[model samples]
Target: MTGSSSADQTVSDAPTAPGGRGLSPSALATGGLVALVGYASSVAVVIQGLAAVGADTAQITSGLVAVGFSMGLSAIWLAWTQRKPISVAWTTPGMALLAATGPVAGGFPAAVGAFLTVGALIMVAGLWRPLGRWIAAIPKPLANGMLAGLLLKLCLAPFMAIGQAPGLGLLVLATWAIVGRFARLYAVPAAVAVALAAMAMNPPVSGALPADPWPTLSLVAPAFTWEALVGLALPLFVVTMASQNIPGLAVLATFGYTPRVPPAFLATGFASALTAPLGAPTVNLAAITAAMCAGPDADPRPERRWQAAVTGGVGYIVLTALAAVTATLVTRSPPILIEAVAGLALIGAFGGSLLAAVQAEEERIPALVTLLVTASGLSFFGVGSAFWGLLFGGAMHVLHRWRPAGA
Candidate 1:
């Protein structure tokens, strides 16, 4: 009877280990810091994008607040279930492309429309299991190449900023890399330390800040247009699924685990669909950022990486509470500081994605085309570079497929 009882226990459940003692709290802290900086950098960029497109500050912030709230909540949920480190970040490339086309295109209504369309499509992706698999079927080389090209512009900001602000930027970059490499636990502290130190030491510290340090949430309305769907929604959806969502799954696979992709995709898709009415962009899997929270450095056991992500979600909540604080603090920081920190944080991730993008035996040319077109920062037919990259790359692949071996 004792032996039979022991057998049932083993079959029903794997032995549970200590839950809280494993991860480097500091690494989680650093990742949260990275998310904070990355979020700030993207916020400044979004403000610029919205302005270029003729959006009022209030409208832009409302839209942004919508996005902010959804992202924070989604990250928390993902962290909870996966019990693996996971986080959701705003679309840097998506916003950049929007900024580029915003002024000349259909305008803010169009942008909101695009966001909604993308959200709906993502919902479709969730229900259509085969479609998700098809997206997964994209050759890794093509995907990785697309990623590198997509990220090319964003990644360069940090080093360029470092060159401009030698005293502060350099210190932050140096400290992040050194501590991130060695102690690991001190990585985030190093970045925060440098940022605080710079703020204290820099002479031009007289920037006036907003009165409210906490955001007051108000309901926002949505206006949709067909043009926006073609221009923003379709392109954003393609990139989110291909570059972000695809690589996100790869991160889990790299760690020798497989998740129920359909549910994950469906849940985020539903999340996006719901939030779109509120003016936030589509929600999808996080690639590079998720990796930071999930990888070996996050937890020695690897199995316990989820704790780091949960920590991040909690931190995100705190930050969200003081979003009014977010705007002020983010505004006070120099653009270069934001850029440099983002660049350094993404170094490892970008490298990995680039490698995965070009490893195919037959599709090298198409892969290169994808990289070049994406890196060129070109948008066409209301579509962003990721779409163009895939279009051109896919065409090239098809063309190559039809070509005779010796013709």
Candidate 2:
């Protein structure tokens, strides 16, 4: 009976090991720091996207609440269950896409419906083998190129921000450079801390901050239309998949943790679906921040690194309570400061994607084409640049493959 009991204990403990042991100080610090950096870098873009879609203050607050809860909860669950450093995030490119797309014909309600559709599509992409295979089958270079193109504009923001707010921007850059010299992982978050301090030192005069930072939940009933389906939903679905989810998976793979794609897709999709009426856009696998949690800095043991992600998840949940405060502070601050921080945060990702896009000789031309089209921000007949970039690049690749050698 003692042996049997021992055997049962071993079986139960085996799975939880992936989530790691001790929840060490290093893991906790890494997780919380990465979470802080992730939120500080991209929350501004999300606010802008929601505002562009006509969300009021209360609605935006609700959106933040929903997004925070979804990402936090999902990341916790995925990391704990799989014992892998799987971090989930709102699609930054998808937010950019929405901001650029502006208002839909049917307004914010229509946009909410489109958000629901995107969630449904993401769920299908996860659950449907054919769709998952199709996504996986996409050429790596083209995917990288599309990501590069999509990010080019935002990545350029630091320079522009410098032009707009020279002192603050320069200080932010200088801090990032200095901190990165010793502790590369903490560099951006440190820069973010400095930038916030600088903002406080020189507060903006607009001073429209709310008295209370507690966010109120607001529901916007979804109204789906054919135009929204074609214009917003389809394009959002495409970019979120091509630029966010696929590359996110690739990032994890590089760290030797290849999670099953469908579960992630389903988790994020359901989260997005449930939060749509509250004004949240789609949530997907995190690309840049995942690298932070999955890297060696998070843990010496690859197996134990899941603790970092779980910690990051816990940090995110703690941050949800501060959403209203963050939103208020960010909205009232000078826009250039936020832009500079975001651009700086994404510089590494942009460089990595660009390298991936051009690494192969055969894929060079197609990848270049994809990057150019995506950066150009060209749209046609309601489709966004990312979809067009992939479409054109894929065609170019196929044509190149068909051509005879020495032709």
Candidate 3:
């Protein structure tokens, strides 16, 4: 994990691939199972974000439906090309960020516009190979620092929620830690599954969920407003890029797999853009969650992870259809059950990312600056901490840059 460039590892270092064009049944099954657990944990974050942004119950449902469908399609298409299990979802941080900026934008439609702007810019970033290369070339610590800084809030959220329901949150947290000991596959599923079972068994928790899960497609007419374009949409785009995609690629490299980053970013950005009006903000690659899907032990055939992603995408579409066509069906879930589990599930992933970010010797200060500013929650002049963390960290690195003539 140290000293070696995980990205530049030669083919000889990689495990030998199975002699096959696609994944075996076992790999596919493992992939699908992991994908489902990961996606389920994050889905409620989307719903909560929409609600926070002042989306009515109906508009919130519509946004989720759109996002689900877009994610499903994007994953399927990208998996077909890459043969790796890549999944896309709402930026949990970005959503939390939006909850801060979204209300000032007047309505959900404006928030959607913000999401659209983020997609367009990110797609451009994908096309701009220089930018992609530069981002990839950045020292791992600075990137990790930025990630840690950005995710600091996420790590803290579960405990905040836990104050209300110790039983549920502790259950999920325990499951997250223990699952790895038995079978890594059991961790996320067991967390989510147990949460659901607890909610079902306990009437008070179960009552929060709809008696019958029914969600219908209700479209929110997008209101084109400049505030959303600047305040909401633009900021979200930056968040997704800095806070989500870059870290996601880092996770991929950490595991010693390299794929086309530009296309992957573009695909997720485009999907988020197309679905923004419905309420889903910038959708992008998942870092920690994707790691769960990509371990060496996940499948005998490494490539079959693509099938897991495809299965997840399909499942997302089904969820979307259900959410869109009927409002109550999926929405009638116990909020704390899923929410607490997601926060708990992400705890380890967040720690791993932060650790990587701060591990570098030369980049430590910059990474620290990035982490401090990001965790500070300082928003000034309409920009958020993600931008500030990068600005401060990158600026620090540049200020210390060495040159032959200057030195």
Worst 10 residues of 2 by lDDT: 1-10
Candidate 2 error regions (>4 Å): 1-30, 52-54, 92-111, 139-160, 204-209, 219-235, 250-257, 291-308, 342-359, 370-390, 405-407
- How many clashing pairs in candidate 2? 0
Model 2, span 49-130: residue lDDT tens: 8878777777777888888888888899888887778888888887887888888878989999999999999998898777
Q: Quick one: best lDDT, which candidate?
A: 2
Q: Global lDDT for candidate 2?
A: 0.75
Model 1, residue 240: distance off in Å is 4.3
User: In angstroms, how far off is 385's CA in candidate 2?
Assistant: 4.6
**What local lDDT does model 2 show for residue 136?**
57
In what order do the candidates fall by TM-score, top score first?
2, 1, 3
Worst 10 residues of 1 by lDDT: 1-10
Clashes of each: 5, 0, 19
Could you give candidate 1's per-residue lDDT for residues 281-314 as a string of tens digits? 5656665566566555555555566666666656
Best by TM-score: 2
